[model samples]
Target: MNRNIFIANRLREVLLNGHWIANTNYKEQLSDISWQQAIQQINELNTIAALTYHINYYLRGLLTAFETGKLEISDKYSFDLPEITCKDDWDKLIQDFVKNAACFIEKIEQLDVEVFEKPFFDEKYGSYLRNIEGVIEHSYYHLGQIVLIKELIAQ
Candidate 1:
């Protein structure tokens, strides 16, 4: 398989499986959680919803670059957090997350594998592929945190 295709597929799987860990059962694992459970300020630092937003935010940018062939680096990392304070808002967030995630992967799927080796001078990682790998690692890192927070909330 081509490098970009492989990376894109893995990124999709990462979001599909490792994105959420609020107080949800297996049946609704991807799209089930109370508003309070989502917004609960776990560990005095971040809410579950906040972390989820952060994950999606970075992944969105990563995939955007692949599709557009432009390295759109952010001037500032300024996402507050995911806040589904009401049922309607929660449902919208869920829908948007699913839709945007698929769209993001589609973007990544369209990229040329040769671009992966191309260097992005402004980005710390030196190459586009490294930056993308950072995106995946960042998601998994927080995913672990989300899982731990869910376990704590369940206790």
Candidate 2:
């Protein structure tokens, strides 16, 4: 299998369609929750909505870099999610997240295998493969948090 295709599939597993890794993707986990439930706080952990926004933040930023050849994202602002007060707001965020995740996967699928070994945007950040895998691992980390938070909120 093409490396790009494999990587894209792995991303899809977490973000959109596949369920082998966690038995639930972001879309599945998020699809049924209400805005109120999304924002429910539990013992100082991030709300589901906030974690969703955080992952989407990286996806959108990386998509921009893939399209425009500029890497402008900062870790400091990755979690700076705006307020989601109503269902419209939460729905819009989810919609944006879905769109960005799809776009991000497409960008990965389009990359040349050689590009994966090249420095992402700067040598300081390491290779494109490093960053892409980082996103996957980082997403899973937060996805676990989201699942646990949902369980806590239910209890």
- Tell me the tens digit of each residue's lDDT in model 2 across 39-116: 998878999999999999999999888888889988899889899889999999999999999999998999998898
Can you write out model 1's per-residue Cα lDDT over 1-155, one digit (the tens) per residue? Answer: 98878887666756764333333321134365676787777668676677666766665665566567676746355356544658877666666666667777676678788878878545555887887787667766776666677777788
For each candidate, the alpha-carbon lDDT, in order, equals 0.65, 0.92
Reference-based lDDT, residue 50, model 2 = 91
TM-scores for every predicted model: 0.77, 0.98
Cα deviation in Å at residue 151, candidate 2? 0.5
Give candidate 2's TM-score: 0.98
lDDT of candidate 2 vs native? 0.92
**In model 2, which regions exceed 4 Å deviation?**
none
